[model samples]
Target: MHLADILALRPVPAAALLMAITRRCPLTCAHCSTSSLLSSEEHPAEWFSGFVETIEPEDRPELIMLTGGEPMLRPRLVSSIASAARSLGTRTMVLTGGFFAPRVPPALDDVAHVSVSLDVFHQREVPRENVFRLVHVLAERGVAVSFHVVGSGPDDPYLTEVIETIRREFRDGVPILVGRVRAAGRARAWATADERVSSDRPRPCTMAAWPTVSADGTIAACCNQDVLDHRPIPGHLRLGHVSSDSWRSIRTRCRTSPLLRAIRTGGPQWASGRSDGGYCGTCRLLGTEQEAPASPAIAYLEQQVIHAQLSAGPAGFMRRYGEARFADLVMLGR
Candidate 1:
């Protein structure tokens, strides 16, 4: 979505502009969310630069997220992205596999924060020693560090190792945000078994600030727009082009409409909440640990999901949704 058209959707001061610089990824994690992999197209650096220029001084945001299968793979990318972000008086953050962290230009370190993906897949593609090196470099440069655990994949034999590693990191105060794999394209077809989940919990609360603009630039009331409405962010959507519309009020009503339903479970004994414990039944069962020795049930589910995907061609689903309209991280509103 065009940046101007996106801002017209709602006044979101804290926006997470998810710029998928490149979809090419070296690691094929078992549970890959967003499924942005090799062969993905990158928006032109000029396009992004123009976007940064379009942000009025008054429209500065708290954070702008640069993500993708691996954003660092863009050969031409250096401080160009960081410079565009810094020019707007906003803090820039990046999500990377850390394989190319060492190659990051020295100037990009200032005013940029990084969230490293450190799952078993990351370990395989990027040496642990290398990840530590990247982390140290970024830390020395004063960039904030956070790690995301990609656990929703078929139970890797290394489940114990992954959990153990993340636990230690969490204990040390390095923030650990558990990422729910969203079912898009191939992930969505077998979502039941694969459980491409997210942190967004259906709430009775109002989404006053959250809004998302799709790649085509149409605006939606929240981040779940693609999942629910299947509408392009800046273009085709349930609420077409909110150019002159008061997006604040429109989004408010849309968020609370009784006839409308989001990805929510009803009543008790149903799945709900942001964390695992908050949900009941199937949702809780997704990752619940038993007192007895771990069985292969969960593992089987993961395999079954993959097997079904393989048989049906998982690539089809992966190709369905290219990228998120916005990258607020949490809540469609930033």
Candidate 2:
């Protein structure tokens, strides 16, 4: 669907929804957000279905983004989501780690896109051969595919080769985005902050341009910025929880937010704090707002944090995607 259509809606209905079907993932990357440590929480299929029922009928986003610890871990989810959107003539999409790439999406034609996260450890976790095998399947099924790459670290010498390979191979016409690791949960628990994390370079987050819905059922201004950027672990209202009041306040505020207004008005200097400088500022702000930095242990963990800049060919591309030699991305689940 056209993003312009969503932009034209009254109250500008959330352009899309982002939901994390499951927080459980197989691959343990270093800078994972969500601080995703709670693996024992079993997400039921019905929970997903109920979440679906919560999206406001008027704002049924044309695109639905399913993410997770690794969304593919939840079997039959992609299919179910597509079916729901198709029932409303909308399209569904997913951000997978290529766990089930070769699998067929049940509701064949309703999927709009499938973004596969291809990082260095991808092969180790999901197996490399399986990823390529799945990508081929997604292509045949007509699901538009994009690559989400996590860059190689300064501590890891193998990263340069991996990035060059991606630039040469998968980056042609296919959308490419870069990202950095935030030592939220497991990453914070184990990984040490890398030198690359301290650059003041700027990056753009396009995810904000689209509407996002969280798994628990709340419509959000953007997915990546949800709880991570919000002050209070972000209330679940946007996830379809205590609707009306929360989002009523948030949505209204977003429309007038200087940042949002700037982007909408084509202000040359748009900022969601997507810079090492801004991220740092925002992080400090988060700490102050939550009284979170007091714990010496967490402070030490933040000290171990690494922030760096990446190359984004597209103007709004995120740069945490380190330069690496990974060209072949295997899509494991659809």
- What is each predicted model's overall lDDT from 0 to 1? 0.44, 0.47
Query: TM-scores, in order shown?
Result: 0.55, 0.60
Question: Residue by residue across 1-334, what tens digits does model 2's lDDT show?
Answer: 2212221231232445566766677666555665443363445667666556555556465566677767666657667777777787667767777655556545434567766777665656666556656655766666676666665344454345554554455444344444445444555565544433433333223333444544443454455433433544443212233233343344444444434333232211222323343433443233223321124443232222211111112221222223332322222121
- Whole-model lDDT for model 1 versus the true structure? 0.44
Candidate 1 vs. true structure, TM-score: 0.55
In TM-score terms, which candidate is top? 2
Q: Cα deviation in Å at residue 227, candidate 1?
A: 4.5
Badly placed stretches (over 4 Å) of model 2 are 1-13, 35-38, 43-47, 54-58, 101-110, 152-160, 163-173, 189-314, 317-334
Give the per-residue lDDT digits (tens) of candidate 1, residues 47-166: 544454555556555455665667666534536756766776766667777777555546446445677777665777777667666766666666666555454433543544654564
